[model samples]
Target: METVIVLSRLQFAFTVMFHYIFPPLTIGWGSFSPIWKRVTTSPENRSLPPLPSSG
Candidate 1:
């Protein structure tokens, strides 16, 4: 019973830590990727048109 309780606590802690750590790491990568692309890419090669704003 004690071992089961300890294992359950460990699993819960792992889940919480994973959830806390994973998102910002991914979000940081997602956010930085565009800037990295822009830095690496030449302006002339970027051919996408600007979208019109609804506001």
Candidate 2:
């Protein structure tokens, strides 16, 4: 009974810690993946406007 209780506590702690750590990582990845893709795909897509034609 004592070992079972300790094991259950350990399992609970592991799951809680996993949840705490993994969600933020996945959420961060999801949030940043798009930006990462864009930046990586087109490094020089940012173009300047045409300059005025001075005589």
Candidate 3:
């Protein structure tokens, strides 16, 4: 019984931590990545260096 309770609490803590941590990071990356890619891979910046977006 105690083992089950501990496992349940651990699962709950993991779920809560995952929910709290991932959403903001994913949202921020989703929003910023495209703009950063565009900036880095722009035609005007081509003379500067090769970017991942260009590849």
Candidate 4:
């Protein structure tokens, strides 16, 4: 029973940690791509209006 509990705790911790690492990297990379594209393709973006300030 103790061994089972320990293994379950380890599995849960590993899963939680692995799950936590993925989203920020995925979202960050996903978000960066569009900005990078805009920077590369749109010369006018350099002087265009700033993005609307979000609340």
Candidate 5:
């Protein structure tokens, strides 16, 4: 009985940690993937915007 309870608690903890880690990884990829595609697809002649000068 005690071993079953411990196993259940371990499974619950594993799921919670997985949920916490997976979303951020997917979200980051979703956001960056578009930028990555754009960079690769953009024309070579197109110039990037100039950086702002520090005052």
Candidate 6:
């Protein structure tokens, strides 16, 4: 019973830790995408289209 509880705690901890990693990655990518788009679409860039609106 004690072993089961320890294992359960470990599993929950691992799940929470792993789950926490993705959002920041997604947010970083989400933020970086617009910056990248802007850099690519600047008049100096002249190759890519204007950045799309978030709405």
How far in Å is the alpha carbon of 7 misplaced in model 2?
0.5
Please, what is the TM-score per model? 0.72, 0.73, 0.72, 0.61, 0.74, 0.57
Which of candidates 2 and 3 is the stronger one according to TM-score? 2
Model 1 agreement with the true structure over 1-55: per-residue lDDT tens digits: 9999999999999999999999999999789767666655667756654433338
Q: For residues 1-55, write the lDDT of model 3, one tens digit per residue.
A: 9999999999999999999999999999889877777776887876654335534
Model 1 C-alpha lDDT versus the unseen true structure: 0.79
Worst 10 residues of 1 by lDDT: 45-54
Candidate 6 Cα misplacement greater than 4 A, ranges: 43-55
Candidate 1 RMSD computed on C-alpha atoms after optimal superposition onto the true structure? 6.4
Write one digit per residue (lDDT tens) for candidate 6, span 11-47.
9999998889988899998999979887987789887
Decoy 5 TM-score against native: 0.74
| Candidate 6 residue 50 C-alpha distance from true site, Å | 15
Shift of residue 6 alpha carbon in model 2, Å? 0.4
Q: RMSD of model 4, in Å?
A: 6.3
lDDT of each: 0.79, 0.77, 0.82, 0.80, 0.79, 0.87
lDDT of 4: 0.80
Candidate 3 residue pairs that clash: none
Poorest stretch of ten by lDDT in candidate 5:
45-54
Question: How well does candidate 4 score on lDDT at residue 15?
Answer: 93
Residue pairs with colliding backbones in model 2 are none
Which one wins by lDDT: 2 or 6? 6
Task: Tell me which of candidates 3 and 5 scores higher on lDDT.
Answer: 3
lDDT tens per residue, model 2, 1-55? 9999999999999999999999999999788767756665575855533333337
What are the RMSDs of all candidates, in order?
6.4, 13.2, 3.3, 6.3, 8.3, 4.2
Q: Whose lDDT is greatest here? A: 6
